[model samples]
Target: MSLSEKVKERFRRMFSDVFFKRYILGLWMMAEGLVYDMFDEKLHVIKTLPDTFDRIFAGGDYGINNPTAFLLIGQKANDFYVIREYYYDSRKHGRQKTVSKYVEDFQSFIGNDQPENLFLYPSAAALILELREKGIKYVRGADNTVIDGIQLVSNLLSNKGGRLFAG
Candidate 1:
C-alpha cells in the first residue's frame, strides 16, 4: 500500500478501540515541550520525506551559554514532521563557535534547500543579522512564546492522525 494508504489503514485499525475514540476528540488539548508525551499513535521511521506536506519550515533558537538548536519541519495541513536537525554546543569543547563558524555550519547543514522552504528562527537579533549577511534569509517566528510553541509541536506530534517515522 502507499504510505498515506498505510497510514490510513493503521488509523482505521486503531479507531475501533474505545480509548482511541476519545483520542480523536482530545486533539484540542495543550501539548508543549511535552511533544513526546503527546505521541499517542505508534511511532514511524521514514527513510524519505513523504509528499504530503504543503511545504517545509525550519525554526531555530540560539544562545551564547546554551547550545544552538534548529529543527527542519515538514508541514501538512496543520501538522509537522521533524525531518532533520542542526545542533551545536560550544560548552562541550570549552569554546564557542564564532558567528562566521555557526553560519558556515548552518549553511552546510541546510545544504541546497534554501530559497525553497521557508526558514524561520526565533528572535536573535545579532545572529539573525549575521546570518542575513551570509546570504541566508530567515523570517522571525511569532511571539517566541516557549509554552505556546512547545504545545503546538506537541499537538502535532501527538495527533492520532499523525504519522511519523524517523530514518
Candidate 2:
C-alpha cells in the first residue's frame, strides 16, 4: 500500500491498542482533552498527583522526578490524537537542548515536508520560539471552544465506529 495508507493503518492499530481500552484523564484540563472523547463510566482515570508533592512522595529509585511536558497533535474536525510526553532533566540538560531534541523528534515523525491539515497546542510557545529561531514553522494552541468542538466531533465519530483515516 501507499506510505500514507501505511501511516493510517499504524495509527489505527496504535490508537486501538493504547486508547480504546481505557478512558484518559489528567490533572490539567489540556491533558484531559487528549482522551476525553472516550470517557465512560467503565473507563479508569489515572490519578494525577500534584507536581510538587508527586516528586517528594515518589521516594528514591522512582526514575526521573520532574514534571513532564507533552506534545500533542490532533486532526482538526476529526480529533485523532498523537501525544508525545517529554521530560526535563534540569540537572544535566538545558531548555534549548531539550527543545532541539523535540524538534528533531517531531521532524522525524512527520517528515520535513509540512502537512497543511494539522493542529498543535501552543503551550510550547517557548519551544516554538526556539524552533522559529532555527527556521521551523508551527501553529499554536486552539481556544477552549475549539477544543470542545473537536471533542464533540471525535466522540460522534468514535461512537459511530468511523475511523479518522483508514488505510
Candidate 3:
C-alpha cells in the first residue's frame, strides 16, 4: 500500500473509536491554532499544536527539545483522506544522526510509488529547498487554498460546531 493508503487505513481504524474520533477532531483544530476558551470573562485563542510541533521538529536536531512530530497530509489512491504522523526523539542521537534518521523515516514512509500530487508544509526555507533538491514533487502548503480548507475544517472541529463524517 502507498503512504496515503496507509494513512487512510490508520485513520479508519482510529476513527472507529469514539474517544479517538473526538481526539482527532480536537487535534484538527489544535493543529491549526483555532480554539478559543473562556477565562474570567475573557476569550482566548489557544495555540495550535502544529506551531509548537513545527518548532520542535525543525532547526537544531538534537535533544528532547527537538522536533518530534512529522505530519504527512495528502490524498490516497481510493480518493479517501490521508494524514499520517510520526515522531522522533533527538535524545537518542546527535544532530546529524537524528536528521539522517528523520530523512530515512520520511523516505520509508513515502515508499516507492511516488504520488503525482504531494504537498508539504515545511517549517523552514532550507528544508523546502532541500526537499526540492531531492526531486520530491511538492507545493508550498502555506499559500495553498487546500491548506486553508483544512484549517477551516480544523476550526470547525475545535469549536465542536458540528458532526464529522456524517451525511
Candidate 4:
C-alpha cells in the first residue's frame, strides 16, 4: 500500500540527514580553509594614490537608519586603490539626514572627479533615483550575492597578477 503524501513527507523529514550534513558538516568544512587574514595590511595598504588612473569609479552603500558609506576608487592596470571614503551614521550623530541631504553629500564627496561608473547597493532605489536625476553617468546596481562577491575579492587579493588595496 502507498503512503499518503503527508505521511511520505513526515517520513522523509524524520529520516532525512540532508539538513544535518549540509548545514552542520558544511559549516565545519568551510571553517577549516576560511581565510582569517585575507588582507595583510603591509601588502594591501597604500600610503599614496597614483596621480592618474586608467579608470575611476565609486561604490556606495545607502542606509537611512543604519550607517551609510561610499568609496572612491581608482584603477591603474590591474591594481585598484581606494582614494577616498565618506561615512555617516545617523544614530551616533543623533540626527537622520533626508534623501536630498544624502544626495548632496554624495555630490560633495565626488567633487570635480568624474567617475566612470557609480555602483550602488542593489536595494537602494531611492538613492539611485536621486543620483540618476542629478545626471550622474553609469549609475548601476552592484551584484548583491554575498558568497560570489567574497570569492571574487578573495581571488583578487590572493592573485599576484592583480591587487586591490586601500589607502
TM-score of each: 0.65, 0.38, 0.39, 0.74
Candidate 2, 32-106: lDDT as tens digits = 335544443333222331222111000001012343343333343422333223344554564334556655654
Measured with C-alpha atoms, the lDDT of residue 133 in candidate 4 is 87
Runs in model 4 deviating more than 4 A are 1-36
Scored by lDDT, the top model is 4
lDDT of 1 at 17: 32
Model 4, range 109-139, lDDT digits (tens) per residue? 9898889999988799998988888887679
Tens-digit lDDT string for candidate 1 (23-107): 5434444543333543544354455676666776666778777888877777676555677888888788688877777778777
Clash pairs for candidate 4: none
Please state the error at residue 83 of candidate 3 in Å: 4.8
lDDT for each residue of candidate 3 in 24-105, tens digit (9 for 90 to 100): 4443322233232211111122222122111111111222355555444332221222234556655554543334455566
Question: Scored by CA lDDT, what does every candidate get?
Answer: 0.63, 0.41, 0.41, 0.80
Candidate 4 local lDDT, residue 111: 92
Give the range of the ten consecutive residues with the poorest summed lDDT in model 2: 53-62
After aligning candidate 1 to the native by TM-score, how far in Å is the CA of 68 from where it should be?
0.6
